[model samples]
Target chain A: MFVRNILSAIIISVAPVSSVLAAGGDTPPIPSQDWSFSGPFGTYDKAALQRGYKIYREVCASCHSMKRVRFRNLEALGYNEDQIKAIAAEYSVEDGPNEDGDMFERAALPSDAFISPFPNDNAAKAANGGAFPPDLSLMTKARANGSNYVHALMTGYKDKLPHGVELSDGQYWNTYFTGNKIAMAPPLMDESISYEDGTIETLDQYAKDISHFLTWAADPYMEERKRTGFKVILFLLIFAGVMYGVKRRIWSNIH
Target chain B: MSNAPREKFDNTVVEWVDSRLPIFTMMKNEYGVFPTPRNFNWFWNFGAIAMFMLITMIATGIVLAMHYTADTKLAFDSVERIMRDVNGGWLIRYIHMNGASFFFIAVYIHIFRGMYYGSYKAPRELLWILGVIIFLLMMATAFIGYVLPWGQMSLWGATVITNLFSAIPFVGESIVTLLWGGFSIDNPTLTRFFALHYLLPFVIVGVVLLHIWALHVTGSNNPLGLEPKSKKDTLPFHPYYTSKDFFGIIVFIIFYAIFIFYMPDALGHPDNYIPANPLVTPPHIVPEWYFLPFYAILRAVTFNMNIYMLAGLGLLAVFMVEFIWRHKPKYLNGFLGFLLLVLGSGLAVFGLLADLNQGWEIPMSAANLAPISAKFGGVLAMFGSIGLLVILPWLDNHPIRSARFRPLFRIFMIIFTISVFILGYAGSQAADKVYFMEFNNTMLAQIFTGFYFMFFLIILPLLSRFEKGRELPKSINEAVLSKAQKAGA
Candidate 1:
């Protein structure tokens, strides 16, 4: 009866977890996407990340900002120091007051974070029709379903609306957004961005690449974290075994 | 009087320090040769693991604070900087973040162990109360520390929790303003939370010392819940329990590290990655998992009216008189038992009543909507849950300490634990439309909240008064021997 009670307790306790997850509104589930960094032993695909970086630079950079990342941090994308320096020099950053007591624009350094096109939030919102374009630094982590959600949203824009669904003036219909209507129009198109390495230039390919890049952007140290976890767990298991033996030896004399 | 005698060490340097301060002698007496009950189960290891987690949190927290900024505008950016720029900052930050969850897990198991074996009874009442004080302090520290990140959840969570104070009658608004140090949870609130977040842990440490001091005075209560009668019933604390505790810590850390490294955000709300924006609110807002059971209690239906509800109301009046003459079991059992039976019947009636009321969404008319009074009632329920724990020793007057021997109390405990879990699950989902078993989240919370309160207020007292538990083993040694013989060891 005691064992049965414990079993029932566990079963009853776990029942709510499934229900809680199921209460994610009426939206269709975000289908999982295959990625290089999907499993415990997974590592980032450098080529895909590089292509994804290009997509971010050309497309997303027009509105969204990656303010948390620095050019030097781009080394994670398999970029060399000189290449990072060259990339940093492309963007101009606002610098300190000069002798004339005025802020000046200077060439960005390797340590400088990604520069914003708009000076402030008000300006950013003004340029984007009163809707603030949020930063992309931790976008994947900020949303549920992470990479899959981003990928689906990117490819989910519908030219034909579902029956009885009417969109507002600037709104577009998407299958993934909590509300079917979205503020931003479709951003990806087939053959829109040319690839230097003979990679396919489809809208779906672009969406997947960008999603992968965003995942890496949100969690840069994931591979290192997993690696360290492996070592720590292995050492602990062995140590625990030895401690169990020691405890047995010590208690044997008494009990 | 300088009480205890110093130990004489064979080493001349050790002998000199021992004679002067007796600090070494104190350690020797308290930790080295302290007599501990021999029949302690694996549950006893949680106290040691909790201590290890506390130290881990403090160590990682100090390093995280060195890089963390506490202002509203800069706080989020500073945390991002720690993750990106600082050396091994992600590691330190993740450990500190997940350590709070892990520490709570340890302390919760420790508390449950005490409850199961009746460690809080008799001479150890103060020790149990001190442990509850530590739990409260830990909650305060964890809440304030959560705000240091200044994310969307941090801003909104701090807003929701602090606003709960306004449910009080007169000085409520003033108390809130004082707590915020301004009109809203702004820069001032962030800075003060940071200060208190750092301060409360040290205060918890001081209380923990007192908790341990109290424990040493009374000694430990074992699984058998019997006092040791002879040396054969106990063993020294050092090699015996120390090795056991070390094994527990290592095993516990292996799981801790998995969460830290593999799925660091498993227990976290994803919305927190966004920077704080006071204007925008996330569609769903939930507290940390540790606080969820209380959160569910805080939001449970307070004034919903129906047939079961009306009958329960009539019982409340009779219960008042029963409270006045609680010692008289004749009246106590008749009235209280009838009252509980009525309410207990309603537990399965949730589905039948589901069709009666619409969802619990806001913006309903004042007539049927959750009213202003509901907020105060919710606040009372949430706080009353913790307040009950502080008076738990007084509540259960049973002579038998171990629930192992008390079949009825053990069953009630299982029911109570399941209710808490149900409440936690209900806390996570939307509290409106029916999602499970023809009942909504709010309804689930209400039912479980009834069970949770019933466990303490009715079930414990009545059972403790009347229960004739099974006969116990003669001593701790006998209990251990019987267990070994049963196992064919």
Candidate 2:
């Protein structure tokens, strides 16, 4: 029994060793970038942001309100502050702190809400059936692949989109919608927004950047987060190297 | 001299980053060595993977719970609002949803690893028991979480499972109402399920810590089922095992990320796409696939067949076998024990496939959808799992002090292999629905389920008799040398 037991043990032990040895023939590749909190942030193109803003102003701003953003905040993304104020002055906003502590109407300050496309909630819903067109302020960060999904939804419309499905006159179809059967119509057009840079002419680019800017608006601190993560990882890596030698020293007597 | 203190501090940070993080140090101090075994194979890394899944679930869940409201009016809309309005909420939700499935995948692998390596044998019994406890808690937590989404599937899954208690003789109605907190599944049920689901993962975490503690006390059982006898038999765990575990975690995370980002909804049920409607029942309700085996067992006991007499007795017998029988190892009757185990596992798999019948889509019409038979496959698979597990100790007939001399045990291993194949075939055959109630022979069916129980309880003690097996090996080296000579000749 002792012999058999010992024999069985050796077989079990040796099989794994051979398997481990066999693994050297098929070396798995390592990822180029080790993703961590410290990994470099994904970069956005500047031209994309300018076009995205135009799309937002022309298409999205009509129905939705970015109540949290100031017109001046646009300058932080490379637009001049003067240009920001000029943009803000175009919108009429509700004001306060008057004799009754509530002034009724004024030109928008840096703190004003973006212009609403519809006159009211009822009008917006009436135009698009009973379903409410959601606010776009944070839509890019609200859903997984929000920018791509939104962009796909905007450009996905086709006549006779699929099967015998009938679309309402104003309602459009998007190929990229989750169920491929969304209620919302295609909202953007190539000629809808004319830009100084001649870039917003593309239907796809317009959809892409509006999505990007919305993403940025939702998580403005993304750049800061990525930078901090990188430094922490660097510090940890250096610390690990020094500790290895210490561990070796501590366990030297065990051998 | 003043530079000495600064140099030391810098050195400490460097060392901590590379080899001596406070976490690692604490683990080392608690575990008492590095790279303790050089040969754990791929299976040992699963515990760490399981840990990673838990951490992922907790992090994503905390973020999701922040935006979620438990009110009846706002619950569904709250989910929609999170999808449309909250920053990064979509990613958080997707990660949490996929994370649950990934956690189960890791736990299943860990359990199978334990089984393959004989990690549950003898001294490591507490580890296995704690693992089972963790598994139970995990199931409870997941069931509760499923209800929180307030989807059609969630409502129906809850309704079906809770209704199972209605099969009880007299007090079943009261018991179910007590469980539901009312006569029907309503706001009280949803509120209670949400609360319990939120509470259960933390309970799992506590149980997991106990699982690891038990594992550490026994150290890890290696693939060879042999204990290390000398310093040459082991290595420090830090650089060796730590690196392997780290690599395993990274690979596991990559797969998890793919599920989180690309195919987040692949594991989800389509019925959940529709909002929860308490008034309407889904065409077919099924629990998550992980719960299918148990569901099958519960259903196998058809109504009108004294469920209390058969199912109640069967479950008690199983509990006693799993827990009480651990103390009396000699009572395990090797061959019949193996058959009983195979039968039980076949029944479990049969249950799983039965639940999956409606989920799969085919291009065929209703006329073509006449139920295909797979009942035989279910019985076989269930029995196969039970067979191998119960007969294992006897199958290793070549005196197992060391793995090197267990060549003759290979014959029994072949038996196990054939049994699994047959069981798998039977399970495939039993996947179709059984709709004939009048012809179903309900009493005879209960007898089969009862036999599945009796096989385990009655036959396990008789396996040792009529077992004049192959001669045992005399020494580890002798066994190895003899094999080598035979190969050469």
Candidate 3:
């Protein structure tokens, strides 16, 4: 009886595999960049991070917010405490009531997060034609091939659309965007943000810098993580060797 | 080295504890002086490694939970805060995240090792079942824990899996509603999942304790699959196995540490880092890596049988056979048979091909008969794949317990492992999509899924009858001595 039941169950379980294949429109492939933080030994390029922060502050900060990151986290990007404080003070942030139970606006402290341009999602959407710009704090970790995708999308805006493809009023053509149309217009242009280090202020440079910065924002502990990882691995290897010797010595008496 | 009775405690403190609880005797008997087969191989170490991973997960998980917020609106941000704001929270979160993948990896190796040695046979059957129950609990725990992050994959995975319960006959919709705690996967679902996630690991710990007790009762099964007859065949577990387990653990830890620190997100889906959005779904939804093989089995079933297409293909096959036989008369019988075989297979293939051009829906009642609806069949197949493991003891009629002594069974075991990996690869692909060979991934998955079941249900039982077994050693001592003699010679 059990055998019969299993046999019937197997038969019932085995069935046809059929479904309409919903093929997505072709997206331009994201070209990989020479990231200073790609491999196990890779560390963030400090200068690139600073430039990226400039681009983010001058351009991207108008719409997108890095809500999870505080001004203090910029210390990882080679910024001094005074520089971070100055940067934080450049933006106005909402503060608590002063015995009047009324919320007041004040210059942001070094501890405060990079505040959103709009107060909430509904307001953000209203300002950006009903499309809320996603928070950039975890942006580098959120999408598949995130870092490259961000870089590509930033620089992928073409002057002409592909043959037979039409863009709606608000939608802009970006080669890297899914369906080749994105709500976000090309935000970066040549000479968008000048670097204090006298680096070239090309659109490509801005895109690369911002992608690097976002990656750092997403995982500020990458350099520390990799360094600690290497040390731990080294210690484990040495410990394992010692353990192996001990095991051999213990087993010799038995064998 | 001797099997003589243990010496009595000389110290009054030891005697006092022994008299009160006999905890010393229990430890000395169960662990210190426990008899284990001397010929047990490295594969045997996986159980200990799995235990280590479990403890690692629990310890790290406790720390993570201390910082994690279970609220829907705050869950994503709280996790980020854990990664950024909390002191060494990054280390704890990474360990817990990668620890899950490592835990599954260790447990899988342990389960496969059990299968390879036929540790589920006879006296050990209950032990294997308890292990399976633990596996079920682990899956539940992992799934719920995944939802606590409240990411894209978390929300959708919860939605997809909870919806599977809705495939029930009359109560399907209500079951989904109950599972959701409201109309859809919302705050309540996240809270309950967090609650259950926190609770199930303790339950697993309880089951694991029972699993260990069962293992101790039967003793450890060795690679040779021969029972230890005398004291010569067995050794005390403390110095020998303990040192060996310690070495194995260090090796396992090196690999675990590499993943935890170096490539922490390698095993995870990047989409999961995005906060959960009900308005949008990712292009492809897939479960974690360990669940992929079973996920593939779940997706293999399709409801549209295409009976008309099958009939048409059959008629075409008949015409082709007649045409071939008419064109060549000398090899008429062989050609006709070969043509018929080809045509029959073609007809079956036709039945399996989903009509991508048409929007045709078969009534649920009709679809549930021979070829079940894709949703219902997927749920059953997913569950049935795991169910197969529970009855594996009954499925194998072999007198021998280990594949080392059964050459034919060994080949089938290899094929079974390969098929499972193939199913895993297929499961990782976007389901319902056509890939290489113009055949959908589900169709590809179905072939492997068939092989997976066939190994247990058909090949194992039937092969056991006809396959000749190798000469058995009288005891483990004899097997070891013979091997040593061969080495010396």
Best by lDDT: 1
Q: Give lDDT tens digits, candidate 1, residues B1-489.
A: 138655589988888988887877888778888999988889999999999998999898889889999888899999998998899999999999999999999998999899888898998899999999999999989989888899988977787788778767798789888889988778999999999998899999999999999999989999888989999998889978899999999999989988998889989999999998888866667788999999889878444444444444456535633552255544556656666656645532542253245574534333243223556667778888999998889788788999999999888988888888889998887666477577777788988998998788778887887789999889988888888888985
TM-scores of the candidates are 0.90, 0.54, 0.88
Q: Model 2, which residues run further than 4 Å from truth? A: A1-41, A64-124, A137-149, A159-186, A214-255, B1-30, B33-38, B48-108, B142-194, B216-219, B228-489
lDDT of 3 by residue, B1-489 (tens): 225555577888997887676778778888998999998899999999999989998998999989999999999989999999999999999999998888999999999999988899988998999999999999999988888999999988887778778666688778877878987789999988888888999999999999999999989888988778899999999888998999999999999999988889888999899999988866667889989998888777655445544454465445433443233334346556676657666655544543432433543232123334456667877888889899888777577999999998888888889888999999898654567676877688989988887676557666765678887889998888889889989
| Deviation from native of the Cα of residue B20 in model 3, angstroms | 0.4
DockQ values of all predictions: 0.36, 0.03, 0.35
Candidate 3: Cα lDDT at B161: 78
Q: CAPRI verdict on model 1?
A: acceptable
Q: What is the TM-score of chain A alone in each candidate?
A: 0.88, 0.72, 0.88
TM-score of chain B of each: 0.89, 0.67, 0.86
**lDDT of each residue in A1-255, candidate 2, tens digit only:** 122122122213434543444343222221122112112456555566767777778777766656445576676468786777888888886666789887688887665556666767678888777666766655654444455556666676666765665666555555555435566656777777787886647777666667677766654445544454455445555554555555456445443
Worst 10 residues of 1 chain B by lDDT: B363-372
